[model samples]
Target: MASSRGGGSQQVIRTGDMEKMSLDQLKAVKEQADIEVNLLQDSLNNIRAATGRLENASAALHDLSLRPQGKKMLVPLTASLYVPGTLDDADKVLVDVGTGYFVEKTMAEGKDYCERKINLLKSNFDQLIEVASKKKTLADEAGLILQAKLKQSSPSS
Candidate 1:
C-alpha cells in the first residue's frame, strides 16, 4: 500500500516486505494509521449526534401537532429564559435548515424534513463505519509489525 506523505511524496510498503522495513519506518506507518483511525471515529461520532438531534426534532413536531391552537405555553428565548406565550399557529412552524437559515413550513412538512435528514445522516454513518473498520484493521496490523521489528532490534534477556 502507498502511504501519502507531505510534499506529494508517497511511501509504498508492500505487505510481503513489512519485516524488511526499519524500526523508524514501521513506527511512522503505525502512527499515521492510528491518526487516520482516530479521525474517522470522530466523524462517525458527529454523524450520530446529528442523527439524534433530528430524531428529537421529529418527535417534538409530533407532540406539537397534537396540541390545539391558542394553548398557553412558555416559549424559550434563551437558555434558562422563557416568556409566557400562546400558540398562535401550530400548523405553520419555522424549521432551522442550518447555517443560520430558517424556513417556514407546514407541521407535516417539517416532520418530513426531519425524517429525511435522519435517513441521510444514517446512510452516511453506515458508509463511514465500513471505512473505519478497514482503517482499524490496518492500524492493528501496523502495530503488530512495529512490535515484531522492535523485538528483533532489541537485546534478548
Candidate 2:
C-alpha cells in the first residue's frame, strides 16, 4: 500500500496498486514512512522526559510538606547555585503552571495539579504509542516491498 500523509489527511492506495508502482515510487513511500517513524519516536521521548520531571516535582512537594516552618534550607536558584534561606510557609507554594506563569496554591492543590498533569501525559503517551506502532508497521511493509522490487530487477547469477 502507498500512503500519502499531508495536513492530517491520510490517503492509502490499495495493495494491488503498490504492486504496479515503479521502483522510485516505492522508495519514496519507504522514505516518507521512515521520517514519520522518527518524528513519532522523538515525541515519545519528550513525553517520557516530561513525565519524569513531574514525578520528581511530586516527590519534592512531599519532602517539602514534611519540613516545619522556619526550618533552614538551601533554596536552589539554578543548577549550580543555591542560597541559604528559611522556610516562610509550609502549606503554601508557588506552582509554575507554564510559559513563565506561576500561580499560588496550597500543598494539596499543588499535588493534585501534578497528579492531573501526569495522568494526562501518560494517556497521551499511550495513544502516541499506538499511532507510532502503526506507522512503524507501514514503514516496514514499504521497506520489504522495496527490497523485493530491487531483487527482481537485479540480474541473477
Candidate 3:
C-alpha cells in the first residue's frame, strides 16, 4: 500500500509483499499500533477525570448560588477540616480562573463561569473519545492483519 509522508514525501509498501516480509516486520506493525492505542487510552482517561471535576464544580456553584446571604454553614478549609462560618454575601464568591489565579465574582457570575468550563471540558472529552476509539480500532485491525500473515506463513492449513 502507498502511504503519504510529510514534506511531500511518499512511501510505497505493497501489502501483497507481507507474505515475503520477515516475522519482525509484521510484529513491528502490531507493536506500533499497540503503542498508539495505549497512548490514546491514557489521554482519554485524563480527559474523563477533568470532565468529572468540571461537572462537580458546576453543580456546587449552582447549589451555592441558591443559598441565602448570611446562611450559617461549615466552610471546608481542607479536605477533612470544616470550620464554622457563614455566608456573609451569597451573591459574592471567589472563582479560580486557572493557573493559580482567582477572582471575585458574584454568585451568578461564578455559576456561569463553571457552566462554561463544563461545556468546554465536555467538548474536549468527546473529541478525545473519538480519537481513542479510532486508535483502538486501528490496533485491532493491525493485530488481525498480523495474525493472518502469520497463518499464511505457517505450514499447517
User: Which candidate number would show the highest lDDT if scored against the true structure?
Assistant: 2
| Backbone clashes in model 3 | 1
In candidate 2, position 24 carries an lDDT of 93
Off by over 4 Å in 2: 1-8, 13-17
The superposed Cα distance between candidate 3 and the true structure at residue 103, in angstroms, equals 1.9
Alpha carbon lDDT at 92, candidate 2: 93
| Model 2 per-residue lDDT at 55 | 97
The predicted structure with the larger lDDT, 2 or 3, is: 2
TM-scores for every predicted model: 0.85, 0.90, 0.77
- How well is each residue in 33-59 modelled by candidate 2, as lDDT tens digits? 788878777888888999999999899
The residue pairs found clashing in candidate 2 are none
**Residue lDDT tens for model 3, 29-131:** 5576567556756766776787687678778777877888888989977669999998888778888787989899987788888778778767766765665
TM-score of 2: 0.90
lDDT of 3 at 45: 72
lDDT of 3 at 42: 70
Model 3 has an lDDT value of 0.68
lDDT of 1 by residue, 1-157 (tens): 1121121354544555666767787777778777877777788888888888899889988988888999998877765999999998899989999998999999989999999999988887787777667667766777888887778879999
